[model samples]
Target: MKTFCKFLLFITLITLYQCKEEKKTTIIKKKKLDTETSSVPEKKIVKAWDSLNRHNTEAFLTEFGKQNPETKVLIKTDFGNIKLRLYKDTPIHRANFIFLTKIKYFNTTVFYRVAKNFVIQGGNSDEMYTQKERNKYGNYLLKPEFRKNRRHKYGALAAAREWKRNPNKLSSPFEFYMVQKKSGAYHLDNEHTVFGEVISGFRTLEKISKVRVGVDEWPVDDVKMTIEILD
Candidate 1:
């Protein structure tokens, strides 16, 4: 009986030791799993579009055009509202202008450059908000969509560009001008991309073009413009 009792105590001790080891091993495994889970990197969130660079600009604008298919817009200014219709031929420029309009970028800008009786340039301003607005959007230029039929007719709307060193004549996406001359500024036909034309705003264009301007062509009084999409 004494031998049996001793054997039973030994067995009990062994069993206890095994149970303790198993508990420690389980705790270690749980800790290891928790550490691994914490160390895993988080997934990145994707956006529909980002800053408009040369590489992604065309595709983004093309897609944006499909999504936001609007063409007619009204430009309200101190002079009067100019009703304009964007041409379908200049798809890229049309989409780009629509995108800018929808974003309310032109609301903070003005007719910064007005060449009396020749052209009234807008989409810029001297105010700090103008620069901030530009900074908020991506910096990019539109590839010129100079259609063979498009010309700088009276009240014609066209994109502005940096003439110096721009061989391709890539248009500045923000700045644009209207040919106020009745005879038409035919000289600028091929040089600038005529993306749209004044539907019925020649009188307003005439008034804006004749605003009193400084030596730099900027109006003495601010010519603020608020744009709204009609369709």
Candidate 2:
């Protein structure tokens, strides 16, 4: 009877050991699955952006800080690095910029428009490649996302337009202008989309804004622009 009881105890011990091992395996599998699931959203985001690389404006819009806070952008120009703070209120414009920077879209574009004592414009150029890329990825019109709190003030970074045909609608998806003077082009309140401001690069902007320009306010020498995110 003692031997029988010992055999029974041994059987119980072995069963408990097997159960413990099974539980450990289950925990390990669960941890791995959680890690993988967390990474899926990130991979999906990149995949979505890549899918929209062709010409989806709304898809491009989703790539920016929707629920996340606003971000700063550093425009490394031929003259100097001009830092700009993007608007948290304007998600579409902010995201558009973030997406553009990630794709190195501004690497070859120039600060083509420079108006002394007024504003400095950038993003579109005579670069055949730029024109072709613009033709490829996006067009030249956004229904001017004008917010009341934001206006065309000094140091305001606003979008540029082609002509006065659409006074209420904004034009130029790529081209943007930076205000340099204090008078403040308030007249442009309803016309252009002001999406950002100069947080640290006003001095650099002043230098670029004062560069020699032709009759069209285009810089005599091309001021090349490259964009990156520091934080």
Candidate 3:
């Protein structure tokens, strides 16, 4: 009977020890699971597109002017370089252009549309990177900033928009064009926002304007361009 009792006690002790080991193993597994979970990287969140109507125009314009006062930019193209000066009267347009240039948004974009004796449109391309950049920036449109004093004279820098779809004549945030005609495009005065004018590189503008374009008005040979803020 004592042997029987001793054997029973031994069994009880072994059972206790096994239970303790199982508990320890469970704790180790839980700790390992927690460590693995902590090692996983979190995903980055990007801001959604804020429409133009939602923006506080007064505050936006004020902050933009205060931050980006310089009104000059140099457009470097595969053909040649074109220097431009933004108009102070069109503060919003000027600030927006400068902001895009500072961010290198024009890099790898092609002078997609070239109309001889009319205009040379740019600031967009068919490349995936161009679309990616645009997506990264978010979707938004700029309100028209037309001034009587600002006309589409030769080398005039103006924003392009969808006239058919946009009844208000809202300017596109990404696309811009340069007037290449010797005479000003007077018809575009109220239609588009003339933000800046070319101070130099008329020859360069001429060269880009003469590039061959297909049916869609896209340049046959890609005329890529990069922009730099001069002032």
Q: What TM-score would every model get versus the actual structure?
A: 0.80, 0.72, 0.74
Candidate maximizing lDDT: 1
The 10-residue segment of model 3 with minimum total lDDT is 46-55
lDDT of 3 by residue, 50-101 (tens): 2123255445555767777998889887788999999999888787787667
Q: State the lDDT of candidate 1 residue by residue for 1-231, as single tens digits.
A: 999999999999999999999999999999999988786677786555445565677888898889988889999987888999999889999998998888788998999888877898999877787787676555677899988899999988999999999999999989998888889999997899999999987788888887889999889998999899999
lDDT on C-alpha atoms for all candidate structures: 0.88, 0.78, 0.83
TM-score of predicted structure 3: 0.74
Model 2 pairs whose backbones collide: none
lDDT of 1: 0.88
lDDT of 2 at 196: 87
Tens digit of per-residue lDDT, candidate 2, span 1-231: 999999999999999999999999999999999988785344434554455443456555754455435488899976778889988777777777776677777888998888788888888778787877776664735556789988988989887776756755755667788898778899888778898888887788889988888998888999998988766
Clashing pairs in 3: none
Better of 1 and 2 by TM-score: 1
RMSD (CA, angstroms), candidate 1? 4.4
For model 2, the local distance difference test gives: 0.78
Worst 10 residues of 2 by lDDT: 40-49
Q: Quick one: ranking by lDDT, best first?
A: 1, 3, 2
